[model samples]
Target: MDRDMSVEEHLGELRRRIIWVLATFVIMLALGLWLAKGAFDYLQSIPPAADLPLHAFSPWSGVRVYMQFGFILAAAGTMPVVLYQVWAFFKEGLLEREREATIRYIPLSILLFLVGLAFAYFVVFKMALYFTTTVNRKMMLEETYGITEYFSFMLNILLPVSLLFELPVVIMFLTRLRIVTPRRLQRMRKYAYFALVFIGTVITPPDLISDLIVAIPLIVLYEISVFLSGAVDRKIRASEARGSLAR
Candidate 1:
């Protein structure tokens, strides 16, 4: 809906987007039910080792696992479409430059998300698995894991990290809007550290090593966000200055 549109019009647009998202989910779920095996295999690939036994607690847990896996794939595939719809809905209120800037952030956002997903897969998942299974291995245990629980754990580990990976894009947008200055972020360094540590503890498993591993990347990402924000702010200001000069 355009800015001139009434509240009813905006509500109509929201309803429409919601319908689209729901329809997408239904279609994906159906497809997922049919193709759960491949989906499960793909999800399993995120872990470092393949030999871990996966058991289903319920009689139909296998079906549930595959269906859920399909849904996950569907959600991932539809992310860009969802984001585009969101952008379209909001674009009318933005200046041309702002619209362009937001459009530019889309690709970077996707890239950052993928990076985060990879980080979760490569770093967190492996470490978590190692931590959990190491003790069992030491005890000479078989370590049979329930399929649903394992997948749920995997989701918990990956989803947050993937979401976290959007730090750069977030900081970039804030920088673009001048909501947060580079110097402001720099000044908040100590606070950021405490927050990162807190976040690491909250998200990771109870072990100190896991907490430390997760925290390090988060801190590094924060620094990266600050640097990128500084660069973006400089570029936006330079562009604005050039525009003023031309005018």
Candidate 2:
């Protein structure tokens, strides 16, 4: 992270940041592989998974699953570094107030992301898995789940929901930057609902109950985002009023 520079210097800076990000990713991936065993155990001990053992159909299935888990862990762990790099890259273009605002909310974004992960795993994932399994049983179908498939299904749900949890922070940031306002969010509400519901449908099991279980929280997140945006918009207006009076 550095100040404004000549064109060549800026290119060098960009390359240096890229190297740092790649290095972080490699380190995190290694650490993730080491921790994946514990994660595997924990997942197996959980409710839906605990009910039935997962099998590997292919010779490379175990390796693939471990790698996927490691990749996910690495991706999650590297998020802060990624955000820092992004902020650093554009820091020179941002006002002091914008830089400060961006820095202040990064940690909140990370916290919300972690909360989303937990919510997806504990609630949405469970509901979807239970529904799918119940359907198979109702149809009198044999239930043999591959480890890879089970986890792939899981990652599909976990990542999106976790990202949705960032809605409020994203709205607050956009509002602070004057790129988004409460009125815009309100006007866009119905379209956003359609998109969120569509996403919820795509990610969850193809069932109304599962879709609602996933979509309802997402809808709530949007509402909370609108509320937060309104609050930030109000503060901005008040600050501008005060500054004008001072002038």
Candidate 3:
């Protein structure tokens, strides 16, 4: 961060950041394991999991389910830490104001993630559960769900949507690194919409309103990402111009 680092120092800094992130992950993973039972019970108290009776066909079914929740919970807990570390790693390149702006993402990322988790769980996951259950019932199939299989389906649906909620943060971080620009995000807007819409349609109940409800927020997040990226880019350019003028 002194901006006088040799290549070796840069590598060493990166290594330290990685270590910190990993350490946080490990600590959170332990906490997650300790809390998984209560969390697991809470998940079961809700719909979908509440409706389905869990069977443990394999001896490892319970363990696998525990691990899944633990891992995701740890990842979620570690997210803010990761963002801060990333910001620190690139500290030297950023102006003081820019650095402050970037650091604010640490908490905002947590808020966004919690929002994503709620949306995914309460909205998308429920709709998906209803659809699949309805189909199974319509086909006159007996619905017996293995504990492992259920969490697998649940997590698969939950994790991606929740993570996509972090798109804006990820975009902002990359923008800070000068890896992606506002213009680049703008160019990809159409494709991004297509993909997000596809995901929305796949997850939601097959209704126009439902699709729009899910897709719109995701689309809006993308726009926000673009906007924030542009904001940071403008700041960076303005700072450079000032430096050049001073010189």
**Best-matching candidate per TM-score:** 3
- Runs in model 2 deviating more than 4 A are 1-12, 240-247
lDDT for each residue of candidate 3 in 1-247, tens digit (9 for 90 to 100): 6588998999999999999999999999999888889999999998878877999998999998898888878987888888888888888887788788888888988888889989988888887788788899999999999999888887877878888999998898888889999999999999999999999988787889879988999999999999999988898899889999999
Look at candidate 3 and tell me the lDDT of residue 217: 93
lDDT of 1 by residue, 75-144 (tens): 8767777777777777887668778878887888889889989888788877877877887899899788
Model 1: how far residue 184 lies from native, Å? 4.0
Task: Estimate TM-scores for all models.
Answer: 0.83, 0.88, 0.90
RMSD of 3: 2.0
Q: How do the candidates rank by TM-score, highest first?
A: 3, 2, 1
lDDT of 3 at 38: 90
Candidates 1 and 2, the one with greater TM-score: 2
Q: Note the Cα lDDT for every prediction shown.
A: 0.82, 0.88, 0.88
